[model samples]
Target: MAEGFLTTHVLDTARGIPAQGVKITLYRISGMSHRKIAEAVTNADGRTDAPILPKGTFRPGTYELVFHAGDYLRASGQAGDGVLFLDEVPIRFGMAEDTHYHVPLLLSPFGYSTYRGS
Candidate 1:
């Protein structure tokens, strides 16, 4: 069985490398309201050093992982002012069980995709 935790990773598809220094924010969502639960920045490996939601804090609910893609790309010299096509990318997903949630994002300056990963 998968461990109970929430995690994420980012890849810079345009650069063909892991997206480092990307700011990520985790939010719990309810009807018409979103509450910030945690925030992290990607390390050299394009992943947070620790789980955004650790095992003890894992819960079943609707959550969103917002990636500051524009800032990251700009900082990495992949995008420029007024030229970035994609900015904050929000991946909203539902967690119904106490299992691991690995949401990985493949990103570029103009596009992005995500999937439920192992």
Candidate 2:
């Protein structure tokens, strides 16, 4: 695919593995209004089967990726009542046209981090 697209991957930092079957939701953000765009579950490689925002669909604006971390961890047998700190992890970023946006998340039950990738 060309440069103007949005993609993501998730890694389970604690288990040192790709976080499969994690529910991810994409949203277009406009001030206080959040509109859902798309939703997908991570595959075996912790990536969506297709780009979140394909080339023709990409636009310059703010977007959010909400990762259902707690549920994924619980399903993987990693999270418990008091041990889970993060549940729905939201990564918000601004995209520019004609540029590839790869937002990868390194996550644990208690903490997570993300960055803009090539």
Candidate 3:
């Protein structure tokens, strides 16, 4: 284990702008167990700037990245006052070894997608 870990970015696909003020929550899961690990707010450039996981925090298991899409789209004036297709988007995946996880969100008002990155 190292001293720190993890990072992320958020891109507003519809508006072609950096998604600021988006809430990102990280979770650690193993078997039937889950726990909140960390949280961060995207910066002006749609990135956390600093590391998401602190040093010596690496662990091999499942993880979840929950992005507050609806709130951000509304704040950015890209979405109207209605039920959104993407409210709180949860991305669940597994980590087999100690490595850096760059989970990025490409979000739009109608749809969204995510992928594991370097």
lDDT of each: 0.92, 0.90, 0.84
| CA RMSD, predictions in order | 2.0, 2.0, 1.6
Clashes of 1: 0
Query: Which one wins by lDDT: 2 or 3?
Result: 2
Best by TM-score: 1
Candidate no. 1 TM-score: 0.95
TM-score of each: 0.95, 0.92, 0.90
lDDT string for model 1 (40-114, tens) is 999999999999988888778899999999999889888878856899999999999888889999999889999
Worst 10 residues of 3 by lDDT: 1-10
Off by over 4 Å in 3: none
Clashing pairs in 1: none
lDDT at 15, model 2: 95
